[model samples]
Target: MNRIEKRLEELKQENKKAFITYTTAGLPDLQTTAKLIFAQEEAGADILEIGVPFSDPVADGPVIQNASYQAIQKGATLTKIFDMVEGVRKEKCEVPIVFMMYYNTVYHYGLEAFVTRCIECGVDGLIIPDLPFEEQGELKAVLAKNEASPILIQLVSPVSKQRVPMLLENARGFVYCVSQMGVTGKGANFHKDIREYLAAVKKESAIPVMVGFGIRTAKDIEPFEDIVDGAIVGSNLLRILEESNYSVDAVKEYVSGFKKELNENK
Candidate 1:
């Protein structure tokens, strides 16, 4: 099994929910991004979703979009992201890294070439929010042949009842359940239906259901702890990193707060 699969299995066995964090690769700078990643791991992040800065990040909220634009301006590219991952690997970092990217980036890289490079870079999985279920067949075949799993984001809206199972079947590492309907970081409050939606997906999915998109605090995760397998914090982490004056120490501190919250709730 890949690192992602193994980690999820371990989390389940230990009865512990994963604390996943997302950051735009090369944000601020490549070195800073890498440092933030290490800090997150040390601060109790189970998996790291490294966002490859793209021009049109439709699924992202303002925080992530701004980060992507900044990273792009700083010369972040697919090659740069891969090089960053390789650099981290040279340090023997064992944390699982999932490239959270858009379909256009993969298309630009060529599907086979993209998957090949991901395997070569020690990447654990993928999260392509733009790749719809009906269109995932070719990518799924490539990933299966490579022994790499492509993670799918399960957006919870009124339409999820029809789409969740289809999304789950194609998903390998875990099912990312978006906590709200709109974009990545726009939700003001967790909807009342979130618990019911998580329960429904959990009942139908064999993989772990990881909640994301408006999750900022441990309190946000408390209500769904029993119903979901993991939590993903993105916008909040990105905001913290940006507001931290690019201090790696600040990044670590923010992640530490989340860690404390998760543990205290546990």
Candidate 2:
């Protein structure tokens, strides 16, 4: 198993839910972004989702959009991001790093080249927000050939009712269960049938099912913590990054709170 599969399995075996966190790469700057990785990991983040700066982010909310814009404006190119990731790995950041980006970026970067670079930099997974379930064939084929392949995670929303099975049929890593049918950020409501949807997904999926979108606090996830394998905190974490003024200490203090809350709730 790759780092992601192994990490999620370890969590499952330990009977503990995951605490996934996200931040845009090169936000504030690449150096600060690298510092944030270990901060989140130190804060008990099980999986680290790094948002790649993109010109057009179809699935992002205002918080992430602004962060991406800032990163791009500050010259956060993919090459720089990859170089930073390699450097971070060399420094021994153990948490699994997943890149959350658009398919257009992957396409422009060239699929094989992107996968090759990901292997070189130690990326453990990918979340392509706009990649349709039907079109994962080519990407999957590319990933299967490489050693320590970076998983291509599949996403499902409450609206993806009938497609859940199809999406999970050959899915790797984990399924990113979108909490509602909307763009990502805090302050959004869970889907009306979110509980049932999650239960159904868990029943159908062989891998772990982790929820994202609109989740700001452990309280927001308390009700569904039993139903999900983990919870991803993105916009909430980004908002912290904004409030913390990119301070690693602030990120750790705020992020570490989730582990306490999640464990206390358990």
Candidate 3:
């Protein structure tokens, strides 16, 4: 199994939920981004979802959008991000790193080249927000060649009724279960309908299901414990990065606090 599948399985065996965290690469700079990755891993993050800077990110909210913009301004390209991943692996960090980017970036980078470099750089998974389920055929084939192949994770929303099964069928690593409609960073609480939707998704998905978008606080993870494998905190984490002025120690403290809260709730 790949690092992602293995990590998820390990969590399942321990009866503990996965804690996946997201951050934009080269937000302030690549050096800071590298430091943040290690800090998050040390702070109990099971998976690190690295957001590649893109010109247009429709799925992102203001927090991530700003991050993307800053990174892009700093010349954060796919090659540079891959260099960061290489540095991460050199430091002996085994925590799975997943790229959360748009399909346009991947396409522009060239599919085979992207997949090959991902394998080389030790990226364990990918979450292409803009890639449609129907059009994932070519990319999926490229990702399936290697034993430690980078998984292409599928996403599903509350209103994804008929398409849910299709998404689940092809899902690898885990399913990115978006909490609500519209763009991310709403930070809204889950209602009864949301709970029901998660329940249904958990029932149907064979792989791990991680709820994201609007999941800001530790309390937000409590309701999803039984229904989901875990939750992803993006906007809030980015907000913390900004608040801490990208200090590694500050980011670690925030992540540790979040982890403590999640453990306490458990």
The candidate scoring highest on TM-score is 2
lDDT of 2 by residue, 165-261 (tens): 9899988888999998879884759988999999999999999999999988888877777789888889988988898798888889878888778
- Candidate 1 has a TM-score of 0.94
Model 1 poorest ten-residue lDDT run: 149-158
- For all candidates in order, the CA lDDT equals 0.81, 0.89, 0.86
TM-score of each: 0.94, 0.97, 0.96
Clashes of 1: 0
lDDT of 2: 0.89
Question: Which stretches of model 3 miss by more than 4 angstroms?
Answer: 189-192
Q: Per-residue lDDT for 67-110 in model 3, tens only?
A: 99999999999899999999989999989999999998999899
For lDDT, candidate 2 versus 3, the one ahead is 2
- Runs of candidate 1 with Cα error greater than 4 angstroms are 148-158
- The residue-level lDDT of candidate 3 at 65 comes to 91
